[model samples]
Target: MTTPKTNRKSGFPAVHLLEEIAQLLAEGPRTSNELVAITGYTKVTCCTRLKQLEASGQAYRVVAQASVTWYAGRKPAADTAAIIPRQPTVRDYPVIGRRDMLVQAFFGAPRECRA
Candidate 1:
């Protein structure tokens, strides 16, 4: 039997990354670090695959603690994706406000007006 192909740098099963990750998820949702430990994959690779799974309807994510994300084998609801915030347009803000004009006039005046 041939040895399993793995990433040379990370010692992670390069060819079967997703497959390995899915099997790990079978036990339960796992934190990014947990995946890294189990598969010997880099943190970045594990997190990246987790996001891909979450996006492709194969996995979901949850907050385990403060800012800790765990990946579970499930799909998120249609509305779970974040809604993009509306960008502020030029019309949203006026170039000069009433207070700004008043302040400018009070602090600055034409040479003749200063007298």
Candidate 2:
């Protein structure tokens, strides 16, 4: 069988696909299915991209449960993906008030409001 097209030095998918996947992973860890959903790519394509990411060291995978796995970069280990500082999820912020202000101070009020 032919090998998947991937960068030998970087192990990343071609530029366009890498950007797509990178956007998704930028939020946090994701499963292969999630990548497929977000990128509108086929299962095979998602799997291929993920494999390339792992090979390139841009992403890593770890077992979440029996027969299930997740992928992430920027963490200590893709296999052991965890927030090093244990921060809050985006949804944790309140509507308005002290809690909201704190969340804004901590995470900077989501991606849109900042810029």
**Positional deviation of 58 in candidate 2, in angstroms?**
0.7
**What TM-score does structure 1 among the candidates reach?**
0.52
> Which lDDT tens digits does candidate 2 get at residues 22-94?
6677677788877766666667877887777777777777775654354556336544655356666666645
Candidate closest to the true structure, highest lDDT: 1
lDDT of residue 43 for candidate 2: 76
Check candidate 2 and list the clashing pairs: none
Clashing pairs in 1: none
lDDT value, candidate 2, whole model: 0.66
Worst 10 residues of 2 by lDDT: 66-75
TM agreement with the true structure for every prediction: 0.52, 0.47
How many Å off is the CA of 92 in candidate 1? 23
lDDT of 1 by residue, 3-113 (tens): 887876557567679867877787777777878887777789888887777777677777756665555555555455455556666565654424456876898743343
Which regions of candidate 1 are displaced past 4 Å?
1-12, 67-71, 75-115
